[model samples]
Target chain A: MTVNAIQTRRTDPYSPPAEHLELQGDEPVAFLDWRDGRKAWAITKHADVRTMLSDVRFSSDRSYPDHPAHGGYVPGAHKGAIIAIDPPEHSAIRSRVMNEFTVKKISLMRPRIEEIVAEALDAMLDGKSEAELVKELSLPVPAMAIAELLGVPYEDHEFFEHNTAIFADSSHTDPSQRVEAIGKLRDYISKLVDARMDARGNDILSRQLDAGLDAEEAVGLGFLLLIAGHETTANMISLSIMTLLDKPDLLQQLRDDPSLIPGAVEELLRYFTIAEVGGLRLATTDLEIGGKRIHAGDAVYGLTNTANRDPEVFPDPHTIDFKRGARNHMAFGFGPHQCLGQNLARLELVVVLEQVIQRVPTLRLLDPISAIAFKEWGPNYGISELRVAW
Target chain B: MSAHIVAKRETCIGAGQCVFADPDAFDQDDDGWVVVLQADPASPDAIARAKEAVNVCPSRSISVLTRPEPGAGTGEAG
Candidate 1:
């Protein structure tokens, strides 16, 4: 391992941390020493990040105590949490629910998603000149969508969203509170899953139960979906809208040609590659990535944020080009572990952007970008809150 | 010779990047596996779409291969 240590903090809101960019430019793979006296390898270049993630030798199991993501790890807490497990268990579990999130299935939900977004906009703009966008629109859209998808009552969105925000936001310094929030969520989902065992519905949870998953497995899957489905997409929605508001030209471009909105969403996703921790993996075997030899049990991190900005892959990478239409970026990560809810998330983003731009033509930021608070310390990158008015 | 797209179902993880890239040329089955809708693109525009799908496919299951057509040229099909 080389003597290059790295930190995950991003100094600039729009870019990955300087340490990441420096390493990407200078080292394909470098030594990363976690603050807890643990060591790992950081793969930053686009090709190398893809090469590492695509290789199954890099395990995603987070149960290992030394795993970077194992800080607050609890064994079997979410029994079917696919992100923290390796195949064939991961493959078996993921395959069971894959069809639910397939392109066709998500497309079928488009009309419903449009309705959700429109309803959110209507509420945000109803007798209100100004509001907190995250509370009013960004959070509720995905929260309500996922709640409805999981057959959890959307009326409980405040409770669901509140606990999830506390649980998902790494900026929350209270570990005990985070655990408590998640536990409440888990119990709530457990009851939902238990009830479904008696009578099923046309939802993901009931379908999982019908597909032969036990109470615990069904509850786990539901819990994972609730957490995974909403918070990340909510963050993305807020961050994307914030960026568009900050750059009026880009906003006007999208207004002129709504066709460019999808591409703009892709570019924004790539540009703000949230989920900086998406690529943490433990090497299960000896491997060579970017010419660096990583032995078994070694921790490896694929800096997806840095990889998305690789000049070779994306010309003038820092500059957001709405016309890029590069779907090949690692914003959703790469390989079999790529985001399962991606299709649904993409559809949500497109729907929200289309409605916001069309419905609120006079929408403008109440505060400048400098005044906005960002979720810098979280597992996902996004704006904490943005004051906006139409 | 003509260029055409092919997909190996066994290798497909059904990430759906192909479907996102070119809906006209790709779709997924009930099992969430890639189903190639266009084996041979007829025009330059369609070929470009096929190439885009191939490029974005995470599993690298889709590819374009140039080969001889049985009746089109002085060459034999494989």
Candidate 2:
């Protein structure tokens, strides 16, 4: 319940792969003991996650402090807006970024996205026979693209990564660091907004200005966009690479026919479900699920990865099928906040996939799949190192 | 022919999901929040879209009230 526990945490909140799947079985909802000494239920099925998302009783409002992952949800931390808020308040903050995050709006950057991936790879593979994909390529694309979209200095990529890491790490491990990250992230966006307003380049930030959004809202949206924009995709980049390494046949299949990349990526996303945990919420009132009593103020987790792999929902859950219906898995999540950045993330993956497959025809793992390390906590679950050799 | 596209101020947190749904029909107002319009929309198709925006709102904030003229195709939604 105290900040001290998270600091010395050992394993993640959820169980490991096989047991994680078993724990998620048939049970529509189950509560986990919170690190902060509270009760929180997990929403494992796709239907349940969707239903809970729209349920007014479950607040998306940030101030709750009762649910895990919300700033205050963790002991020794405060709260942020949007992702942490409920109702029109959350809606207000989300709206500020909607224009930029809109499918059409993000789609406009297709060429820019392509260019970013191409250049990032070039730099990563410059003179090395072996390269760490996540550090060199996977992370930078989203970081750069989000930074550019928000009109932040490209040089600030390292800073954005650091702050986001701090913010996310705070949620999982250290509550105090979370505050520091939030402040830094907020400050960076504020300064960037002021700078972009004066320069008013034809970027996402300037468009918000043209649309008459105020400085705070605009900056707020930028913060959300920058974070929401990259985090998952970055994890996907590393995790997907790691997943491919675990199965060489699939990697070869992708290599032979690059056109299959998009569908393959979706399957990978659906199958991987790198977002180990879903957004947390407490029931505003009593709710019954899976023959279990869920009282009001009880916490619930929408375990998207588990839901995506449920045997009933997806036949042969363990096996990854290229032709199977790998989509409809709650990877992008479900309902209202069902990943506003889905299109952008998909586009990034598509472009990244196309570029990687075409550029490195012989790309293979420099290290064994088992050796790759994963992050201890946060939404995007991924490995620490993914070394590829050509 | 003029249909007022009003947002229940309480329901609207202004995430611009509606604005993206129908950019031509909506805009942000003076307060940097969503500006719900009461004017006649650009076309019947545009008005129909204003209704879809209703569903996309995270909060039940937006409702498109149609003020139909005589013989306007209100019966057959665009």
Candidate 3:
């Protein structure tokens, strides 16, 4: 099909588009994105997405002026962030903060994570019958965990959280305002990084400082960990709860067998696959992926949401089957640029879900599913607010 | 059965699946690169876990070589 003939699939935050699901058997489709008006290739199949992500020839360096960005966001200008850079620079920067997310290290934080979850749940229970899960439990748990990790004072969470929400909300279209929000975050993190240099704490920022990263590098690392550390996990938590409430059978299964919580979490992650835009890369050399030849400097967007639901790899991909091995899903992404904090995200989800099912036995959505506000466009896909009550 | 584990550090991407799956056999260094703790594991559980680690490795940098049984002949070598 010609690029002009390919329709831009309308995406729902909760479900993969029917158009994308139907186009699974076809070659990777190309389209001019309505938002940016840039022509790019959309990788739909699971095998193709994985291959595109792993291939070194497809560069993640978006800092270059020619790199393709969605909706006029120039990633190349935002230097020092690990996601926007390719290796060996990416590997070097990633290694400095990698130890903080190891299973053993994150497992040590389980007690504190559980405490945060309990406090949030307690506030929700004590307040009102109709509680907003996003604000109550979903946002606070990860916010607090990441705050503690970055050694940022918990009292100032509101400032950082609000700023992060602005950039994360795809509907918030004021470019100038987004730039201002980023500026505020950078200044806030810069101060924190400076303070940690004088008085090093046990948090990730202090660790980065102790490891000999300059002030600027430390700020970039801290900025990435602070924004990414909480926002993605918080959204995943909110989305997971909504999915469980929608499917009472799945919720009941978790309630019946608490051991199924981890498996259920994996399945939920795969089914939702929140990073709707997938990983973005500009080809460093001419490459052929899925029978399509991409020339040098071409931009390729991996549609991970579509890939996760590709029937070739996942039999009956539309259905959420907890029994299936879904850990390999690209929800956390694949290849060298896979999520740095996946272990922490997984631990937080497992703890929060298990506690909610065990403690809040009667928890159910207070609002109709149709009324829920889902984010229409953004790097991440999740609900804006999820109202739940027991 | 005993198994030999080798971690190709050059190819390791620090996904840490090996350490997650079989901590006894594999551990990460300060930089988060894989560090093989036990090349020859004695326990059957560790051996099984090592196999899982090999399967889940994103970079395919891990390898497990199992030794033949005590009385088993090496027909191929002969």
For model 3, the superposed segments whose C-alpha errors exceed 4 Å read A2-14, A28-38, A70-79, A161-181, B1-5, B22-24, B38-55, B63-78
What is the full ranking by TM-score, best candidate first? 1, 3, 2
Q: Which scores better on TM-score, 1 or 3?
A: 1
Error (Å) of candidate 2 at residue A356 is: 1.1
Off by over 4 Å in 1: A1-6, A72-76, A154-158, A165-178, B42-45, B68-78
Clashes of 1: 0
Candidate order (lDDT):
1, 3, 2
Clashes of 2: 12
lDDT of 3 by residue, B1-78 (tens): 557888887666777878767888888876778999988878878777888788667666788888766787552210
Candidate 2 regions exceeding 4 Å error are A1-16, A35-37, A72-80, A153-185, A197-199, B1-78
Candidate 3 lDDT over residue span A81-111, tens digit each: 7777887888777777777777678888999
Candidate 2 residue B10 Cα shift, in angstroms, is 13
For chain B alone, what TM-score does every candidate structure achieve against the true structure? 0.79, 0.67, 0.84
Q: Give TM-scores for every candidate, taking all chains together and pairing residue i with residue i.
A: 0.92, 0.74, 0.87
lDDT at A22 for candidate 3? 57
Highest-lDDT candidate: 1
- Model 2 - which docking category? incorrect
